[model samples]
Target chain A: MARTRLTPEREGELYAAVLDLLREVGYDALTMDAVAARTRSSKATLYRQWGSKPALVVTALRHNKPVSLAEIDTGSLRGDFHAVLQRTDDCQMEKDSALMRGLSHAVHESPELHQALRELLIEPEMTGLDELLRRAVDRGELRPDNPALKYIPHMMIGAIAARQLVEDRAVDQAFLIDYVDSVVLPALGV
Target chain B: MARTRLTPEREGELYAAVLDLLREVGYDALTMDAVAARTRSSKATLYRQWGSKPALVVTALRHNKPVSLAEIDTGSLRGDFHAVLQRTDDCQMEKDSALMRGLSHAVHESPELHQALRELLIEPEMTGLDELLRRAVDRGELRPDNPALKYIPHMMIGAIAARQLVEDRAVDQAFLIDYVDSVVLPALGV
Candidate 1:
């Protein structure tokens, strides 16, 4: 007797294995053979599901990303930013966070991956943050026109990512909050 | 004999060859054996000059990084920002610019190299830009209590680098200038 069902849970497991491979071997070094071995799936299965490594990688990242922004009713722009940063802080602390290292490596090498990453990983979060800022602008918690607003997401998330990519150290959440309040808020003239 | 005595220019040529080897092989793959073979120099000579790959790579970067920042005498803060962005535009156009790729890779891989890259390559430019901004603050071109000042350099450079790193496209100078004028200057209340 054998478990013959290809369940959704099995798909999720395979996708996670792809992420692990992407992180361990990097973009250039990642191979289907390795993914098959790691996932305990046949190479035929990977090929049947995803045509190539790029497709598999893109699919993995799409699944790996958070489905949507947290619905935060923190009542202030600063509070919203804090909530968002805290969520991101938790994600970065995960040991198997391919979102930071592996997928980023693929982005560097492939334009298609980069575009997919921005669309899947960056855009939805930014759109939500933008909506939050819009509400703040209406409420007078923030200036209507903040230049730093344009770069805040990049600075907060991208700065942490950039530092992680460089130092391979855990990001300091307190320092990030201070940065938001002292540097980002004041810059926005909040 | 084709040549017996090596000129100073020949020494510089040998160093350039070592750098070319670095680009081809990357830091970890680069070796004194490869450098000596490529440069047609004795292994003893490379060992006598630069003891290790890091030293050689650092030397090459120091020698190669073109005017990280030039003093801009633009009396207005807007003028200085515009000027700096223009220079950044030019630097971003070079395809074979090892300084960009190599330093980026080095910074990501090694902390010691990151510190050296920051100190040697980035700090000088930041210092000059800071001095220029300090002068602007002194002249009342910027607000005294502006916390955005800290984020400005990171934001400006990060936008350019992030766009390039993710998008694989050249940063538009006009768009950058507009971004500064419309978003940054207005946010600064200048």
Candidate 2:
């Protein structure tokens, strides 16, 4: 095996730098050199750590996102979805949300990046959401095989992310409320 | 004013070449030289017409999208959404869809391109969807102020586009049916 380098702390610094650069330059213009310069790390350090631009960008995004979900016990599926989507709204509108923008550009260009992103940023959060929905089904809130559950997360975030990238608009709390009340609650067959 | 040099047909040919280059190479690797070669036009000719890469790419996207909506009287809100979404699915999954990919990448790097794309591609489609929804409300099939209606078209198409870009997946007839049953009808309070 070639060697695994970078302590978790060092990785955190690198990701913070990447986040700053993403906000300043957006994804396509973000350069590894700028990341090294910002983090006071050598170019060799980044190459040794991440191996490629896509890898580095992916790591940075994964780092920025809340990969694990809070335990959902709001006592109802509708309550849980509203809570989850509320957190989603917060993440999308974070103070410096270059991670979302970077992932949008990266996914569009590279399938590898897209897959990694789907696994790291999208899948984990949704796995938690899926668990919550499964609990709802068990509780008879939805059909046992309600297919809409499969695509709901994709639909909710997809709309917001696509709007952000295509319209250059920022998501906010009010929009999330409207989205959940108007889109998700109904789509779940609630 | 300088005399208009390239004929309309020649301009169309060059724009078509830009789209081809975008599909083949993506925005990062695409260049005006490649476009000139692809179209069999001189570099000078391209510059004289488009002036820059963003302008050229934006024009190509604008020229390629079929913006005119089909005047269909499906006589129901859900029916109309299904019809329109199916039409959009066909356009989104076309083989030469690098235009979509390139535009997605271009928007990441250039806010100007993002805004232009919204104006040229997203806005036209969204406007048609909005008008369709408005008519449905007038028919009392949907509540006039249902917030979900505002986001439904975006949600449906966003799901398709995001899936296509991220998962190498495209929207199909079955996906459309699921969307109507789960999202459209519920949002209309049916």
Candidate 3:
């Protein structure tokens, strides 16, 4: 079958459709046929573009994530952390949580999906975070070899995810601030 | 239909079958019919005993967990944490990780499963951890009103889970010790 070229706008539509289907039916039950039907795109085009269900889903997740890490600088480590936390709060709406929950099992089951999620979706954010932390180290706000540096992403993001999972509570701005002040800053010896 | 009374040993067998099936097929794909076929138990008996697939899976996870908090204390908070970490290492074999990954999406989708997981598998462990922390506070090893106390579970377990999900690394005894010493202890000002 000849491939139909999708414009950037059309690509975004397909991603939105995939994410919507993910929220409704979840990863396992979601099918390529459903995505094609929802988006009014050809199944062959989807396969041609993304190869498989895991590939399409991974690409959709990556595409949906706000990958701009350019505006995260805030001078001090605490300020930078707070800024990032605020950004996280802004992006992590209920629908995003549902998508994350839906993909959680599939990510673990498929190495390709896990790699794509980590590298494409999660790594950009982590890189941005690390850059902020590195600036703090350079500015003498933190020590060069703080062991807690290794755990910042895991600590902050994990706390947010775990809170939602274990307690069903949203990690709002207030909670993020509290987490930074109580758990993160203290652990870093700030 | 007459209900079959399963002995404690038979009940254990059924739980094992459920967990095994969950590992093989995941929460959404697993069926009561499959469970009945695997265990050679009547579908009516399974329904009578567990009510639903979520209930059965939750019960199976709870049953497999080493639920005794009685053996967690080891005098000092550090010692107690180490003991608990060791037990966690022993219990969190490859199979357990697989089950956890399998159930991650389902837990979010079903409130019943989420509650059952927290109550049965997670809460018992947390209660034990909190008791140890409380004892430490009473002994003046930690401040009575430290805010970081609320986040200990999230930090430790979250780090372990995050490492597996992102880095594909096992949360071994060494890593747990490092986490407790560097992250947990320092945050507690111990």
The docking quality of candidate 3, as DockQ, is: 0.55
**Rank order (by lDDT, best first):** 3, 2, 1
C-alpha positional error of residue A181 in candidate 1 after TM-score superposition, expressed in Å: 2.8
- Report every candidate's CA lDDT: 0.65, 0.68, 0.77
Q: What DockQ does every candidate get?
A: 0.31, 0.41, 0.55
Residue B180, model 2: Cα distance from true site in angstroms: 4.1
The CA-based lDDT of model 2 is what? 0.68
Per-model root-mean-square deviation over C-alphas: 5.3, 4.6, 3.9
Model 3 chain A, poorest ten-residue lDDT window?
A: A85-94
Q: Which 10 consecutive positions of candidate 1 chain A have the poorest summed lDDT?
A: A158-167
> Which CAPRI level is candidate 3?
medium
The residue pairs found clashing in candidate 1 are none
Ranking by DockQ: 3, 2, 1
lDDT score of residue A83 within candidate 1? 79
> Residue B143 of model 1: what lDDT?
77
After superposing candidate 1 on the true structure, give the runs of residues whose Cα lies further than 4 Å from its correct spot.
A1-12, A65-67, A94-99, A133-153, A161-169, A183-190, B1-25, B32-51, B68-70, B88-99, B142-146, B165-168, B179-190
- Give the per-residue Cα lDDT of candidate 3 at A67: 41
Model 3 ranges with Cα > 4 A deviation: A1-14, A28-59, A88-92, B1-11, B29-56, B88-92
Which candidate ranks first by TM-score, i.e. highest?
A: 3
Candidate 2 TM-score for chain A: 0.78
